[model samples]
Every structure is written in C-alpha cells, then in structure tokens.
Target: MSTLTTAPDPTSETAQLVRRARRHRSRRALRRTSALGLLLAAAVVVRVTLGDYTVTIPDTLRIIGGADIPGASFILMESTLPRAVAAVLAGASLAVAGGVMQDLMRNPLASPDILGISGGASTAAVFSLIVLGLSGPGVTMVAFLGALAVAAVLVGMSSGGAKGGTHALIIVGVGCSALLVALTHWVLLRADVYRLSEAMVWLTGSVAAASWTEIARLAVLAAVALPAMLLLHRQLRVMMLGDDLAAGLGVAVERHRALAMLGVVLLVAGTCAVCGPIAFVALLAGPIGRRLHRGRTRLVDIALIGALMVVVADYIGAYLVPGGGNLPVGVVTGLAGAPFLLWLIVTRTRVET
Candidate 1:
C-alpha cells in the first residue's frame, strides 16, 4: 500500500489568524463586559443608598428583599429605586443606540441625538404635551411614532441602500434636527407659563419624577429591542469591514442596516419617552466604552458604561449640587458633554490637518 501525502492548504494559515483574532477580541470583550457589569452594579447600589434621604446598604438590601424599613421604604420604593432604574435603562439604551449608529455610519460623530431621532421624538412629545394635552402613555406612543417616522425619512433621504450613505445621512439628519428643534422652540414659546415650565423640564431631561409605570414601559421596550440588537451583533461586526465585504459574506447589507436603524430608533424613542433626551450619554458612551476595552467596541460594555455615566450624573444632580434644589440630569450631562465635544472637534481638526 502506498501512502498518499497531501500538501497543506495555503488558506489554513489565514483562517487560523482570523480565528485567533476573533478569539482575542472575544476574550477582551468578555473581560470588559465583566468589569463594566460590576461597576454598574456598584453605581446602582450607591445611587439607591445615597441621596438627600440616605439609606444604609443593609437597609437597602432589606428593602429590596421585602423588609419594611421605616423612612427608607417609601423613599426607596417610590423615589430612589425608580429613578435609579430609569437612569440605568435610559443610559444603556442611549449608549446602545449611539454605538449602533456609529458602527453603521462608521462615523464617531453619529449618534441618535445628533442624527435627529431624539429631536424628532422630543418635538412630537412636546406637541403632544402642549398642543394635544396628551400625557403619560399617549406621549410615549407619539414619541415612538415620531422617532420611527424620522428614521424612515432619514434613511430614504440618505439613500442608505447596500452601501451606507453616511455623509448624506448625517447632512439630512442634522438639517432635520435643526428644523425640529426650531419647531420645538416655537411650541414652547406659544405655551402658557405652567405648560412652558413643565415642557422645559421634560426637554431638559430628568428622572426626578420617575414612576413605576414609566419604568415598566422602558423595561418592556428594552427587553424587546436589546436582544434584537444582540442577535444582530455578528452582522454589525461584519458590516464594520464595509458593505461590499459584508454583502459578499452572505449578509444582506441593506436589510441589516435597516434593522440596526430600527433597533436604534426604538432604543432612542423609548429613552426619550421615559426621561426625555438626555444629552451625550449616547454620543459619549461608545467612545468611552471602546477606550475602556483598549479600542474594541463591545455593545454590552458600552451599555454598562452608559448606565454608569447616567447614574453618576443623576447622583451628582440630586446630591452634589450646592443648593438643595436638584438640577435636571440633562443639564449635568450637557455640561460634561460640551467640553468633551469641544475636545473631540479640536482633536479631529488636528488629525485632519
């Protein structure tokens, strides 16, 4: 019997390299995810236990476990708990939305707020609040519809088909955002003092009045949307290599892109409905998450980081301000985000130069 020897396939080395790279990325993502998860948990504990009306950790644990602690019970159940939950959900949603947008567009500057989804939702919400006199669930429904509509218009305007038309998308989105913002201002200007004040607070963003109903609504939206995004993770990773490459790999580029945009819209709309447009959480979360994981973007890490940012910012607004009066969470985030934005612009300019 003669033994036949076959030469090794030349592509095996490349395949091995690809597998190794993927495994390395997965390990890094896992480590970052674990770290962020722990940090987010700690932040939530701190947020719930430390406030104007402080609750000890043990007492908080007891309250969570169904123990009836005196002063802590009402405050925890009604106020701190709900607010913290809202912060986490809103932050995570915004961050995930932003990450998806950035990855889709391959533009660091692309975020739901910047691309007009949040603005559209805010405008619709304000109209519902002031003109239609809608509140609660009605406003949320309007906001969701408005976001979806704007996203559809944006995608159509950009012609983001098999190839992601990022530049056109950005231009159209920014213009639309400007128009929507102007309309929101006009609505606010014509409103009565009481309505104006309430609208302003909502526009500026706050979880101060967070309720169980709002929490439940956000929870449901997140439950539905986040898993969908996760399921699209492989497509997202593939698309990062460019549309043609992604399409060649058996990914339906346009379809996946549209699905990703839908997921982003849902996240942003739900967040806006619950807490209004909390500035820069989405914009900042992706970059921060990437940095934390040594420049690898993991969706879960981004979400956790976003949650941490919002929880910490809310804590500052509620407790760290000099006066007894609380600031809106948006105000704190805006203040923080503006500087970061400026730095980003300057750095980008430097890089271009």
Candidate 2:
C-alpha cells in the first residue's frame, strides 16, 4: 500500500513553537521550585543550628509553622518570618527588575538601581519622611511614583539618541543615581536625630526593621507584578533581540519598553518600600542567575534564582553571627555582589577585546 505525504500546517508550526516555549518554562519552573525548596530547608537549618543560640531544626520548623512556644513563636513570627519574607521578595523583585533592565537597555550591567530608578524611589521616600513628614502608605506611594518618573526620563533621553547606545545610557544613569543619592544624604543630614536613625536602615539597605506590615504589602505587590512579567515574557524576549528587529516583527518597540519600565518600577518600588532599597540584588541577580541556569532559562527563572539567593543569604545573616541580632541582608548581598561585579567588568572587557 502506498502512503500519501501530507504538508505541515503553518498554524501547527506556530503552535509547536508555543508548546516548546511552554515546556521550557515548565522545566524552569520545576528547577526553580526545587531550588527554592532546598533554600527554605537550608535557611531553617542554618537559622536553628548555628544562629544566635543553637536550637534543633525540628524545633525551628515547629516554631515557624506556628506551634506556639513560650515567647519563641512570637519572636519567630514577628522577627524571623518577616525578615525571611523580605529577603525572598526583595531578591525576586530586584532580580526580575534587573533582568528586564539589562534586556531592555542591552547592557549586561544594566539594573533597576543603575538607572536611578531605586535611587529616585529612595530619594522620594526620604523627602517624604524628612520634608513632608509622611509615613506609612503615603511614603510608599510617593516612592513608587518617583521610580516611574526616573524611568520615564531615562526612556525619553534614550529615545532622543539615534542609537540606543548602552554606554551612554549607563553614564547618564550613573550621573542621575549619584545626584539623587547625594540629595538623599543631604536630606538625611538636615533631618532630626530620630528621623535619621529611622532612615538609617533605608540608607544602608537594612532589613533590620522588617515587619508583618512590610511583608504583607510587598507580597501582594510582588504577586501582581510577577504575573504581569510572566505575561510579557515573549515580548521581553523579543525586545532583547534589539528594538529595530522587534519593530520589524510588528512589535511596538517603544510601547513595549514603556510597559517593561513600568514593570521594573513596580518591582523595585515595592521592594524598596519594604526593604529600604537593598543594594546589588538588582545588579547581581541577572548575571548570577544566567550563569547558574547556564544561560538557558528565561527572565522568570533568573528571578526565582535571585529569590533563592536572597533567602539563603538572609538566613546566613540571621543566624551566622554570635549575637542574636544580625547584620542586614542587604549588607551581605552588597558585599558579595561587589567582588563579583568587579570580576564581571574585567572578564567582559577581556572578552570584548
């Protein structure tokens, strides 16, 4: 019997590509979920066995799961859980923001804080505290808007240039960041002693005052923003291929960039609102995540890896020191990221030449 040959359907080809992308995402999700699980376990182990004073892992887990202990559960829920949640949310949010910035700006060094985005937020929040005497949700709202404003300015400036030169953007962003940071410092210096003390955690990127209020707010914002990023996954990937190419493929390049910038602002602002603009997670996460996943995973994967890193690092900070009180998670990440950043610059220059 003779068998007739059939032509492949064009829609089927497109559907296949879509299916492959979904499969890739699913695999990445599995890997990240597994990594996060391990991180949680490790965090618990580190917190219990070696932190402050030694407690058994089982006891720690019980404390975490809310079996009331005498004054222990109170401490864990009030202090430890908040800090842990802050670490995870800050890590994931900043990393995703950085990944988006890097892709949008076409610069490996691009980050949310790099473009004065977080600096703007920090500056605004500081102004609110010192000048307007604002607090609570008002401060957060102002910071969020400030971040968006900086992003808008950057996009406008970049659009004016004939070529979206990455170096030019970097230089401009650095200048803006420095100026805003200087202003923030000036404001802090002029403020009252108590206010300065209060702002110290923010200025230094500390999670020292992590609380349930901060956790709940950031968690909701992150939940919304993460899904938004996921929905734009394909658009972001296209944008990474360059604006001209994306435009040629019928993608509204400028519009997409604008949306992406909004995503970055939301991600970074929500994080800064809670964790006080923790440094380097935005700068380091994308590159580190790319390296960890062998450059195979998408931005979402990078975000998950970042979350795991922060959670793990926060656990170390919480438990590694001799005293019950620990350094801020931001301090630890900043220390770690600085050296890696230097290495990246050196390696990148060498490779280019």
Candidate 3:
C-alpha cells in the first residue's frame, strides 16, 4: 500500500493554469485599484487644499476635524470640501453605472449618456429649472424620476430575448438620445433669456455649488447603489457565457439583469440629478478600468478612476481654466473625453455585442 502511487487527474494541469490566471488577474486589478484610490485621494487633497484660496494642509485637516476657524472653515467645509466630496460620489456613481450598462448591453460604447438615461435626467432637470421654476432637491427628484422612466422604457422595448435584443436596444437607445436632445432643445428655446442661461449652465454641469446636504444625500445613494451593483458582479460575470449556459449554471439571467439595470439607473439618476450629467465619466471609466485590470471590469477600479477623473476635471474647471469665472465640470469632461471617444471608435474595429 505504501509503495502504491496515484496519478493526478488529467485535467489538473489545465485547472491549475486557469486558477493561476484568475489569481493573476485579481492581483493586477488589486494593484490598479490601489493606485486609483491613491490617485483619488491625492486629487481630493489637491481640490480641497490647493485651490486659489489655498487652505494649508493643517488648517484643512483641522477643518475636516470639525474646527470652526472662521473664513477658512466656511471655505473648506462649506465650499471646497462639499464640492470635492460631491464630485467623488458623483464620479463613482457614473463609473459604476457605465460598467453595469456595458454588461447589460454587451457593448463597450454603452453608457448612461449614450443610452439616453442622462438625457432624460437632463431634460427633466432643465424643465424643472426653467419651466416649473423648481430648484434644489425638487429638480433632483424630477431628474431621478425622469431617468427611471427612460430606463423602464428601454427595458420594456428591448426584452426581445438575446439574439436581436441587444441590437434593438442600441437602436432604441440612439433614438431616445436623439429624441431627448431635440426635446431638450425645444424646451430651452421656449425659456426666457435669464432662465435659459441658468439652464444652460446647469446642463453643462457644475459641482461648485454643491452643498453639504446634497453631498450627504448623494453619499447615502452611493452607499446603497454601489453595494447592490457589486453584489451582482459575480452573477453578471457568469451570465456573460451565453444565456443558455448562464441558465444552466442556475443564474436567473432575466431577473438579475433587470436588477442590475435598476441599480444602474438609480446610480445614473442620482449622479445626474446631483451634478447634471457630467459627460464621459461613465463612458471612459469602464474601458480604462478594464484595460488596467487586463480583462473584465472591476467596479472598484471603475469607481476610483471615475472619481479621479471628475475630481481632476472639476479642479481644472474650478481653478486652472484661464477665465476667472468657474468653468463647469461637464465642459471640462467633454473637452477631455471627445478626443478619447474618437480614439476609441477608430481603434476598436469590432465591438463585442
């Protein structure tokens, strides 16, 4: 018995390699995640402390630590800090929303903006501002409702099963985007000049007026929506291997997919409502995250990259732009993202879906 030997399973080598590859990918994602987090932290610090007013690091820390140091406190806690925090939360929400959209549509170019989710929110937000004379949370609530309505329409129209559903969804999304754009323009055309300027600026997106109350509310939204998306990640990954295979593996593909979409819609609406639809944070973050992770998207990486992107963009818009007036963060993101979008279209010959 002692002298008898057993052979390893025939598939052991392949299984081991697969496991090793997975581990490598996980480690790589972890590295990038950490780097992204650090970068985001640095960005937040810079945004909070190094603006034109230039709050010293110690005073900034004290301000964060709840010191009421007169003018410094007002600048730090009321203005800079809230704006920075809002940008981070909004960015993370948009990025995670993008990742979910890509998974659902199976298209790398898919995002809240492209699918008209942002358009819906923007339309409602502008209407509430100019037509209804609503401001603050009222506009945000309208935007969220508008986003949900658009997402529901999309899900309803695109549930034609897997074969042609994706294509139909893409077509419908583009149409929705165009229709929404026309509607937005029509609404704007009817606006008074004074309100039109306000609407235009809001549509361009700015975090400068971010209030602590708004930040608190967005933080709560993030706490719920982000976790929900992350919880569905493994399920979504399994579902990627064809519907039949996913069903065989015991995933309720339709249910989970719908759930994921709900989460995505919530996230997109929350961010758009809070800051208007800051363009391209959702579009760019997922692909960059996937490239860094060397494969499928990691929600954390996507979130971190997105947060950093918006924070940096906001910083530029807020302080670094040539004009003394604060530039809208949306404008900055549009400027940075347009070239990248062109590059993506030219380079990516075949989109998976």
Candidate 4:
C-alpha cells in the first residue's frame, strides 16, 4: 500500500508506437498496391484484347498461357503482347525513376523528362542514329552513357557537388535539357528524309515496334533495379528529412544519393532506349500515385499507375485518335502532361502568394 508502482518503460512504449505505425503503413501500401494492380490488369487486358485485331480476353489469356487459339495466336504473340509488355515495362520504369528523383530532390517538378536525363539519352541516341550510324544496342548503350554523363554534370554544377539542394540541381538540369533538346533538333534537321522520319517517330515515343527482345531487355533491367530501389527505400526516407538530419541519423547521404541517382539513370535510360522518352509518365506518375493513396507515395503504386497511363494512352492513340493515323504515345502524354504542368505552376504561385 505504501509502495508506488514502477512507471512504464519509455523505450517499450516507443517501440510499440513504431510497430503500430509500421503496421498501418503496410496495410495502406497493400491496399494501394491491390487497387493499382487491378487497374493495371484491366489496362493490360484492354491493350491486348481491344486492339486493331480484337482478340477476346479469354483468347488473350489462353494465348498467354501457350494455347494456340487459332486466329488470335499470331496477333497476340507477335504484336499486341510485345507492345503491351513494352508499354507496361517502360511506364513502370519511368515512374519509379521519376519517383526516386522527386523524392531525392524533394521537388514535385523533378523528373527525368523535366531534368534533362531523358533529353540527354534522346540526344545521344539520335546522334548515334544519324551522325555515328550506330544501330541496335549500340544506340542504347550510348543513351545510357549520355544519361550518366548528364547526371555527373548536374552534380558538378550543383551547389554542394553531388549533395546540392533541390533548386540548384533542377535549375542546372533545365539548362542542360534545353541545350540537349537544341542539339537533338539540329541533328533532326540534318538527317535525310527516311532517317528523319524514323527518328521523329522514335522521338515521339511509340511501342508499336516493340519486340520480344526489347521486353526481355527491360525485364532484365527491372529485375535488377526494382529490388535494389525497394531495399533503399528506408534510406530514401531518411534522406528526405534533409542531409544534415539524415547524416545525423547514420545515413550516408552522399553515397545513398549517388546510388539512387544511378538507379534512376539506369531506369530512365532503359525506358528511353526502348520507348524513346514517353513524355510525362515519369513526371505525372508520382503525383497521381500520391493522390490515389490519399497523399502517400509508394514506389510500386506509382509504377503501376505509370504502366496504366502508358498502356491506356497508347490504346487511345492507336484506336481513338480523331484522324485515322495512329499518334505516338508521347504525343498523347505530352498533351496530357502540359495541362497538369500548368496547373502545378498556377497552384504553386497561388500558394506562394
């Protein structure tokens, strides 16, 4: 009766709170993933089934499972399947890359397309195509190299070398992008008609020429990069709290940031190599994913949303364009993203005011 009870352990309570928070985040992530997964599945079904050939969903499934469904088999195997796969891979890769960049930079406007990474890749690929006469994987390799080079340049130009603030990096990136885009245009102007036509279509970004080879390449890249990014998510979260705090919390800010940049470069380069810089999937995916999940941004959800966007956009370009000719997926995404970009600027201005 005279003795007082011991107080509860603060460490134990803190641990419990952390566990609860983790559990809540896990549940939220699962729900978001499930919803986005269903959307992606639907998009894939529509992409394969409702194309110019019109394969039934059942037939599409059967064909995918190695059943020869007579008329649908060839179409599904040769064109539609590869195209759909390419769109999904390209979109997911770009989205994840964009999400990583935005998270690292702590800027909604930061993305491969906006920050000159894609432009660098595109410019290099175009140069290889027209000036150097490189073909096949050579162009892809050059694109990758170009992207890495741009990343290096951005880092150097930033205020604190590789650990600079978001604004400096973005500003430098925009300047670099403008330069690269000008070079791309100059290259286009110098090309002969046939080569120019090919480059133009590629620059516009289409999965129309998607093949099994391209799919396999993307699959291999994703197999390596996606899991690595997932593992780095904790570090990314810490990094989000600013370098000083992150470093104080035992995060190697520069090293982790460099690693993240490498992953983003690989992803962006790979997608651009295959799909030729499909516009805005990277730029829009992170924000859309956040909105869909009630202001949470999970990389997997963002990737799925990006995949859905590309597939749906491609479908619309292929079958729904007012004029008969198919437009590039890039064009559709560009049209969509431009408005969103304007809205972002307006809202940001209003907020600042």
Candidate 5:
C-alpha cells in the first residue's frame, strides 16, 4: 500500500506567494528607478547642450571645468546652466513634499498648490513685497512662516474633526486656500504699477531669471529635507495600512505625520521663495513615480521624475516654442497639470461612486 502523502500547509503556500509578489515589486522598482535616473541625466545634458545656441558636449564640459569659452562661457555659466540646475532642485523639492503629503494623507489630491499652502506663502510674499517693501530673504522668510502657519492650521483642524483624515484636511485646506488667494488679489490691487508688475512676474512662477545665490539656498534646503523624507518612508508605509494598524505596529502616527507635514511646508516655501510656485510638479510627480515603480515608491525616484519634468518643460519654454517670447515654466506646467487634475477628479469620482 502506498503511504498517504501529507498535504501542503496552506499557511506555507500563502507565505511563499507573498514573498514572490514582494520580490516582483522589488525588481520592478529597481528597473524603473534606474530608467528614471538615466532620463533625468539625459534631460540635463540636452538642456545644457541643445539650446537656441547649441554648444558641443565637449565645450559644455570645458565650461563647467572653468574654461573661458567665449559666448558659450557667459550664457551657459550665467543663465542656462543655472536655470536647469534650479529647475532640478525646485522640481525635486516640490515632488518630495508632495510624495510625503500624499503618502501621509493617503490621498493623491493633497499637494501644496492644490491645498493652498503655496497660495498662503504667495500671499505673505506679495504682502512683504508691496506693503512692507521687503526684498530677497525677507520675502522668503515670510513665505516660509506663512506656509508653516497654514499647515499648522490644517493639521489642527483635521485632527479636531470627527473623521479626522483625508476629507477633513482637503475641506479645511481648500477653504484656507481660497481665503489666501483673495488676500493675495487684494494686495496686488493695492500696489502701484511697478510693484504690481513685479508681483505679477513672481506669481506667474517663472524661473527664467533664477540666480546662483537662490539656487545655492534651494540646494541646501533639498540636502536637509530629501534625506529626512527617505528616512520616514517606512513609517509612512505603515500608516498607509491604517492608523490603528500603524499604532499597533509601534509607529507614533500623529507625531510622525506632523513632522512630515512640517517638512512639506519647508520644501514648498523654499521653492516658492526661490523659484516661484512652479505649479503641479508635486501633484504630478508622486503618482507617476508610483506607477513607474509598480511598487512602494522611493522618494528619490519621485524626485528624479520631477526634476525631469521641470527641466524638459523649462527647456521647451525657453527654446522650443514657435514664438520668440519665453513662456514661464509655471505656465507650461499649469497647462499640462490642470488637465491631469481634472482627470484625477473624474477618475476618483467614478471610483468612489
């Protein structure tokens, strides 16, 4: 008689399946992140090398190496190079902020510009420029404080609500944003023609005039914030499963969320103060990164995707348009981002209904 074969344990079979799925996701993430990194490098090279005034790659390298290569030297060093670098920094900053907030809130719709954090910063910066006659660092400081205040209010309100999560934050944030926008309009209305013109340029979100000093400041902000964001990824993923589950797993959900929220504010405010509010980089970057990775996304992946979008858009705005007039990088992103936002709203509605 044949001995009866023991059956396979269901639990063991299930564990194997889980392990297999996880490995698949890990491999996908690695492939996608590598591809995005390559794309970003290529975008930077193209922006530097193939402009209205094309410079050879060898000459571009020489310029970076501190060679005085005539017309190429001044244009590449003073303007085009700086603009591309700033776009990368600012776009990466916006994306990380968005990725953190979206992950924390479990909502793709929770970006700074959409929720009015940028508007609050803009309102304060405009006030400083017009009423207080502040310039440079003063405006940046005011914008930072304003973003912090708005974010603090949002957290307080959301936590105070009965449900106290995505819906509450979105509702309170939209209301605050409207109020901030109105205040900005009021400030602009009161300013003289010269100040009004200056405020308008900034409000449009153009980095056409980005300076080396501003880029340096933004780069430092990124250095501090990007690592902090990556460090929180594990905590954020835990919370995404549910607050109760996260708490049970030994994660301090509320405290971590607040700290993460503060980081978002720092990133948005710094970018606003330096590059103006480049619309939709934050809103668009994380979702795209998640799709690309086909798994839980890395903050760096999201950041590189954002940098690519902005650098490419900035290049198009500066050089690709039929009209000689340069489009503001903000305008290009807004045109592209607004449609995506509408699509998200529609898609989300269908899913909810």
Candidate 6:
C-alpha cells in the first residue's frame, strides 16, 4: 500500500509556481500604481506651496481648479504652473524613453543619455547657435534631425559589429558622444559672448521659461511619439529575453528593435529640444521606478517616478539657492545620478568577476 503512492508531476508543480509568480507581479503593479497616485498628489502640493509668495494648499487647489486668485493668478498661471508642467512632462518623457531603452537593450545601464541621443541633440543645437545663429524652433528642428542621425549611426554600427549585443550599441554611442562633446565645446569657445550665454543655458538645461507655445510644440511631438512607444511595450518586454528568444516568440527582432530605437530617438529629441539635454532624469528614473515597484516595472510607473523626481528636484533647487536663483534641474539630477551610476558600475564589475 505504501509503495502505491505517487508524487505530483514536476511540470505541474512548475506551472503552479509560474502562475503564482504572475499573480504576485500583478498585485505588485497595482500597489505601485496606487503609490504613484499618492506621489503625484504630493508633488502637486509641494509645487503649489513653494514660491516667492507661497500659496496655502487649499488656495493652491482652488487656483489649479481655475478659480481666480487675483494677485497670484498672473504669477501662478504665467510662470509657476507652466514651469511645473514642463518639469512633469520632461521627467515623464525621459523616464519612459530610458525604461524602453533599458528593456530593449536588456542592460541596466542603458539610457537615452548613454546611447548618444542627448549628445546628438546637443551637437546640433550648438551648431545652430554658433554657426547659423539659429534660435527657437529652428534650433529645435536641427536638433531633432541630429538626434535621428546619431541614432541611425548607432544602430548601423551595432548591427555591423561582429557579435551583436547591447555592449556594441553602448560602445558606439559612447564613442559618438565623446566626439560630439568635443565639437560642442569647441563651438562654444569660438562663439561670441552673447551667443555663448545662450548656448550655456541650452547646455545646462532649464524649463523655467516654458510657455504655452513650447508646451504645444512638445505636445504635438509627443502625440505622435507616445502612442508609438506604447505600441512597443509588449514587444519590448519580449525583447528583454534576447533576440533569439524574442524571435522564437514571433517578434521580428531586428525590425522591432529598429522601430523601438526610432521611438526613443523621437522622445529624447523632443524633450531635449525644449529642455536642452536634461542630464540625469533618464538615467535615474528607470531604477527609481524599479525600486518603487519591486521586481518588474511598468512604463507608466517609470514615467510617474521620473516626473515626480524632476518636480521635487526643481522645487529643491528653487528653495536651496541662496540668491533665490534656481539651479537648472539638469544639474541637480546630474549630481544625484552620479552616485547611482557609480554604484551600477561597481556592481556590474563585481558580477562580471
């Protein structure tokens, strides 16, 4: 009778484990979504509370709801609100771009900044300023083209390498970035003092002067690009399993990767054109989202985390600067992101060893 007993099938037990894992992941995603909503509410409160003349949270709510606060209306509408909106948009856009790139490349360190998107935009913007004296939309247009060109070069190089991998892409991007940085500095040194001042602002990145016009331009660009990004989300997850696995799963590996790269290029270009190579928002957001959500991360969560960080950082810079002049959010992000970058490098090296 004891010898007649049988154990459960191993495959059945494995399937059960997978189902449980999927359920856990789903629950985690939902909790993260709720947390993100709370963080967004907090960000709005903080933004409304900080300024030369702070508004009470209740009054800020009224103002945001379109009720007029006579003396504060102009400042709130024309300056603070627009700037806050820009920060939110820029943060979310960059973060989404970064998360997509990381997943597509299957590399923790992959980001728009790392992949030469921002550098490409910077090179073109600098050229427009120093060579053609172009400003406004013209500069942005050139920058957009530059980002496309650089991304094309990167993909081309990566595919042509002996063995295709994320490393090749990163290497090509880093090489291009190094060359572009040198050229940008040269252009800056050669420009007149006045133009140099303008270029300086572009290089440092600030959304302080965002207008309805600028926001509209970004909105239009995002309208075309955002949906494209969302379309790639599932394919991008498949892509994380490597080209062979993705292909086996019915993904057109090369085609999807190319299209995904193009989408990120458009996103980075659109944001960089308006905000001027915002430094570390892209680099930091993906990890922050992962940390917040635990395990797998969603595109929306990453975007929300990025947006929240940028707004909070801007608020900090506005308050911390002794003379009341705000530090560019890019600079603040760079400072905060450097340590994270260093840690990634160290951990990566240890893993390799």
Off by over 4 Å in 2: 1-33, 48-50, 53-66, 160-164, 321-325
Q: Candidate 3 clash total?
A: 0
In model 5, what are the clashing residue pairs, if there are any?
A: none
- lDDT per residue as tens, model 4, 136-219: 788889999999999877655542434446777888889999999999999999999999999999999999887788779888
lDDT comparison, 3 vs 6, better candidate: 3
TM-score of 5: 0.93
Q: How far in Å is the alpha carbon of 176 misplaced in model 6?
A: 1.1
Error of 6 at 113 (Å): 0.8
lDDT, candidate 6, 156-275, per-residue tens: 765522156778778877888898899899988889998899789878878877787887888787778777787788887887776677788998877887898888887888788788
lDDT values, one for every candidate:
0.88, 0.78, 0.85, 0.87, 0.87, 0.81
Stronger candidate by TM-score (2 vs 6): 6
Error of 1 at 157 (Å): 3.2
Model 2 per-residue lDDT tens digits across residues 1-353: 99999898999999999999989977876777677567655764554355454556677688867687776666666666566667777888898899888877877787877779999999998898888899778888989998988898888876734254888888888888999988998898888988988888676676658678878888899999988987776787887777777888998887777888899999988888777888788888788767766664367667766777787767766666457466677777888888988998899899999
lDDT at residue 167 of model 4 (Cα atoms): 75
lDDT by residue for model 5 over 106-129, one digit each (tens)? 889998887888888889889999
* Estimated TM-score for each candidate: 0.91, 0.86, 0.92, 0.92, 0.93, 0.89
Steric clash pairs (candidate 3): none
Q: Is candidate 3 or candidate 4 better by lDDT?
A: 4
Decide which is better by lDDT, 1 or 5. Answer: 1
User: What tens-digit string does per-residue lDDT give for candidate 1 at 70-114?
Assistant: 888999999899999999999999999998888888777788888
Task: Give the better candidate number (1 or 5) by TM-score.
Answer: 5
CA lDDT for candidate 3: 0.85
